[model samples]
Target: MDAFYASVELLRYPELRGQPVVIGGGRNATPDTLADGTRRFKRLRDYAGRGVVTTSTYEARALGVFSAMGMMKAAQLAPDAILLPTDFDSYRHYSRLFKEAVATFTTQIENRGIDEIYIDLSDLPGDPAETAARIKQAVRDATALSCSISVAPNKLLAKIGSELDKPDGLTILTAADVPPRIWPLPVRKVNGIGPKATEKLAAIGIETVGDLARADLELLQANFGRTYSAWLVEVAQGVDERPVVVSSEPKSMSRETTFERDLHPRQDRGELSAAFTDLCTRVADDLRRKGYEGRTVGIKLRYNDFSTVTRDLTVPLPTADAAEIRRAATECLKRVPLDRRLRLLGVRVTALLPAGSYIAEPQSVQGELPFAPD
Candidate 1:
């Protein structure tokens, strides 16, 4: 899963293997050539619109290209970098291969994303460290891909442990190993800490884990609200007891888009309807690809000022067709106030069950094909 999308591009076009490659918007970008034989340099911020960097190769990273950065900003950093489109279907195939490889050792596998996983080694062979090494080796042998394995007393340390090394990393931590290794890092490195928490921690001189460890729980509670404050303290002390969850289920599937300008549904009925249909098709495609079916079809609307609302309808049967989903969602849309100017619109399908899991009723609407949306 290393530089996943870009790596796949490299495999497809072996010529790009050693170059600094980036995968983002569909087109491959290079320096703009002028008639005079001079090339123009581009900055990522200088590029247009909503695209985000999906992944970039290590060489591209050295040029300040990284994932989730704005595509335009990345173009500015490495304009001559080879750009490729994201091939998620191919990525998913590799994901299944790697997961199936790891599953050979233990069923206690947790997928973090397309690139990472957590394997519970305590229940497996030899020392946990030795077991981790073997697992890493086995994965490489199976897929020709290297992976980092973190073996720890618990999930928290293991999560951080897996990341300490990159490309191929292995870290082992015990309950007693927290302070020296984990404390010096920024509080932001802790799983739940986000931009807001880091800013708050910085305000109170709690920039590092050590500083947070010395913080008063009550003061943190006052700042972060009770639930999050308690979690912060536990993180500081490496007190995570959360079990490594073996099975992961998709809770919902959704699609949303932001428009260039606010649009009132009543004022722009044609445009809004088209966008809604687009979202439904995308979500339905996702459901089919993931082998999932949803009992509920829902719509979400974010007004011009960003206030949001959602409505849903429960269908008698789960489906993965775009037209059926769009029809169901349109019914849900009737419950929303269309007069409000909208900034965003989303469609979601939830209450999911694995595809083919349901038994159809014998008589009512038996095997009826879903009607196509207009």
Candidate 2:
């Protein structure tokens, strides 16, 4: 999927084609009907909340706006950009359509969230390029959207190749292409190498994939520890042996909201409590819908400074009950120091088990008997 959310929005408002458009506003930003019956959209300049960019069109990207950027700051960059609220239902609908379309060709697919997937095409009989083309076409036919496809020997190179080209792109790479193509790229381009690793690599004069590949084994081990160091060397040489997992179980379900304005925990206690309760209710509903119950209930708080904290409490029994979840979340919340205004609040349920499954209590230690044996 290419600029997925924005592209989906384009299907609804084709009139905004080739113009800078952003998605992330609340329901209040929905397009209004004009006297002439034309839809008038809210502009980024007119946005007044603390909402962040969920996605933006390539046209918006041209003006230096990107996803996860604050809407207020993005407005300064592309003030005239059209703003639209997120429609996750439509996004999920297209996600299912595209995945189902691809499944018709091959079932060995690893879903990487909603917009991306990894399909094992090694068993398929055809040229890799042709197979990629077919998959791309199938996706487009299913959803009326364009997606970039990259076919490489393994997941690492394939992921890198996928981003080499933009909207509606097809890229093919092999192990032979690693030295010439992958080595010259920055170390950060590797799948597992994140900001902290990138900074560490830079400090040690290992900025590019080539640099990492040629770095001394001893130097890497001394810096990144034995396990990660060895893994880093193998990945730099394009040696990813991990197989694509075809399926996975859900580990947790959660609901969260970022405030339009920072809300004080004490001053805005009523509003904060309402939002917290709503999040827990939503999480409970999600658990029941998905047929799971969780033993660990948690709360996440993000202060106005962008710092975040999370606390979790494990209960004796797993539950999908809204009141139980809320109670657990409230207990976790009590552990956090709310000295600053909160920008975001979230509730999460983890340590999941199938709903209605038998749960046995832990055996009590003999020496640690009730009342310490008096």
Give the top-scoring candidate (TM-score).
2
Per-prediction TM-score to the true structure, in the order listed: 0.81, 0.88
Task: Give per-candidate clash totals.
Answer: 8, 0
lDDT of 2 by residue, 219-243 (tens): 9999999999999999999999878
* lDDT at position 364, candidate 1: 61
Give lDDT tens digits, candidate 1, residues 68-130. Answer: 987777888887787665676778777788788888889987777777776666667578777
Q: lDDT values of the candidates?
A: 0.80, 0.91
lDDT of 1 at 65: 93
Candidate 2 lDDT trough over 10 residues, lowest sum: 365-374
lDDT of candidate 1 at residue 179, scale 0 to 100: 93
